[model samples]
Target: MLLFDQNGWDSRTYLGGWTTLGATADAVSPSTGERLGSFAVATAADVETAVDLAVSAQKTWAATSPEEKAAVLRKAAALLEGTTEVLATWLADEAGSAHGKAAFEAGLVASEFHLAAATAMMPYGQLLRTGRPRTSLARRVPVGVVGVISPFNFPAILAARSIAPALALGNAVVLKPDPRTTVAGGLYLAAILEEAGLPPGVLNVVPGGADVGAALVDEPRVPVISFTGSTPAGRAIGARAGELLKRAHLELGGNNALVVLEDADVEAAASAGAWGSFLHQGQICMTTGRHLVHESLYDRYVELLAEKASRLSAGPPASGAPLGPIIDAGQRDKVHSIVTRSVDAGARVLAGGSYDALFYSPTVLADVAPGQAAFEEEIFGPVASVTSFSTTEELVQLVNSSPYGLSLGILAGDAYAAFELADRMRSGIVHINDQTVDDEAQAPFGGVGASGTGVRFGGHEANIEAFTETQWVTIQGSIATYPF
Candidate 1:
């Protein structure tokens, strides 16, 4: 039987000790809108129970050595690899990912787990000299239970980014995944962790929506919230976390740009831009939504970009086109509206711009002006907007004008020139000779301004530090006498 049979489902909430059936949420295929099955929807009360259990179990888990934790992560990585095919199928059905994209997401899950395992056993902590006579040492300690809320775009991999590291650092996690892709996000997640020998109550899965998420956030026991979703929702979480004085690590929206400089190879830039703009139907946060070209190469770059985008088709994964449908009608309609409005506002559509069913053709819009939606907003779809700039200053202004500062890409002839241009761009990650949609498990991945909450998902000191707190310990060689 298929792992994600549409006929029926056996979804349930994974509590600390056992799985329990609860309120039902019907899962539907994004590609066809067909009912996949009804799975349990966890409530606020259920969230409380899960958090309580996690808090109880965190004590024992925290005492476990980093090596032991790393071993568990390695085992989980192997188990995840074993379920690659099934995981890919579930993601394709629920998240509207093409076969290639689904496979990539599944593979990334295991690789990120391995990286996090290595990070767990690495040397951390330091002995500090504060110009004091006492010997001082800073040690890392777990930050209690962590609440992870993931979006549907990259359900398996994005959530694993936070979960693996948190567990590796001796902190338990309570996950609340998006309702749209619950199976790939939450249902089997706990099972895999348990199978990897994770102690019960160390990790729990509660599939829920907004209210459930709010409950998780409000629960004072859960000190840290790692969320990946829209910018508006991110702001809300940030505000609430601020009110409660809790830590929030958010990986939110992006309106990234790929700039084609005068010295760039038009064909190469166009190919990279097309892939960055249309991959996974532009559902990725770092998808290049805007294309800024130098006046010298604007026309040629636009022409090549249109040609490359036109060759791609949007359909099922088996169709062989690198593109696929949007997550659902709502997202599809939004993309269609952006294209239509851009066209009405004098932006010319050089390639396909229509949709049949849930599939939206890859579109390339040229002569996009300032007022156009495609030029102004995060059109999270298979659409790319092209505009021209005379100088690097103008290009920087155009890229930084967007309220979102997620990422930017520069296609320059010389590496030094590319890095120079990249340094001026106000994004978290700047790519030279590559597209903006790139992520690694060991990089400081996140955005600035509206893109994220100034917190990184992985890489360097921040990723490991996010899950643990530093304690300053000082000891004296001899006991001091106090005068009464």
Candidate 2:
């Protein structure tokens, strides 16, 4: 029973130079169902305090050189590497990430900072190639204060993904992490930023539920909002931001597809499908929700995939299980609802659909046809809906039928053919020989339609552009000799 040290790691809110302690509820460990610790639920007043601080600090931060911001990010990354074990342990307990996945997230969080560090020296603005005597230049300026709202799925990595780039681009942030991940996500996350010499009021953390999140969004001082969560919530935020005419950056839900062509190697494809659909219990937005294979390869692929899924079990992070429980009972039940509804609608469970508390089995539903909830919706659990398609046109139609356009995966022997088909995918990202669940820090990562809004986040130049407002400057060579 690894309980938290109540004296040190208890409920708290980080306000630049100060910390506040008082929680509305306790954060429970998903694996053991034990109380990990409590976290302070930020009230509307708390949110006001944070926004006021950010508004004051951002003016100073935006004036600093990019190199100076990069130094702080690098120092934060070094501090993260030193605190890996402790953070990983708490993340596993609070978020229920498996040991390997938890460790991977910790490393990836550190790497996210490095990627942002590389962008520090890159061009923040561009000069036009006007050959005229007068000079014309364009500069990218920060979008003032950024209000960040992150989900609990990959607490450290997801928060870092948005925070690193925003900070690198000279934006002060007021972050509101989900209550479930307050300690693992907000506390240490902000502590590192503060210790790395972030000036007072540059970064603030208010851990709470919907009210705190809503307050942050409603505040007028924070002109930009970066949120990662479900589409329903995102839509609401989008509407509010629109009413306020504020800039918004959203990375939302996904119901991705994995297409296996007739010529694909069934064994390899099955292995990839298993890992993509089951990693972190399919909590990732990029997780494959549908597996569509050509009729000739469907049966064999299903067999191999089921066999692989059967070997996995959800347990504590240190238990060497391949996965872990869902975030909590409500989320666990939501996943099971899809499984039950699919079964009631005539889908056959080929592998596993049983649940012991929050640990949902890696379920595979066979012959899941159209109109089924599992087939049409985002079954964001360790569940894979397997079905077959005949022609290439049918495959394309099936994949594009869904509203989501986040990512696509294609497996085929003919490399060019795979790329050709992938090009037509409605998704923002497509992989010829890999699973849909993939990301790199340097590549542009975002989606079209409901999957995301605004520009992508990565180490690319686009990220800098996303968080910045552009201004064009022109120098007049001589006072007008024209008419007057």
TM-score of model 1 vs. true structure: 0.96
Candidate 2 lDDT at 465 equals 70
lDDT (Cα, tens digit) per residue for candidate 1, span 270-358: 98999899999999999998899999999899899889888889886656667777887898898899999989999999998998888
Model 1: residue 220 alpha-carbon error in angstroms: 0.5
Best by lDDT: 1
Candidate 2 overall Cα lDDT vs. reference? 0.85
Residue 404, model 2, lDDT: 86
Relative to the true structure, how large is the alpha-carbon lDDT of every model?
0.86, 0.85
How many angstroms is residue 68 displaced in model 2 relative to the true structure, after the best TM-score fit? Answer: 1.9
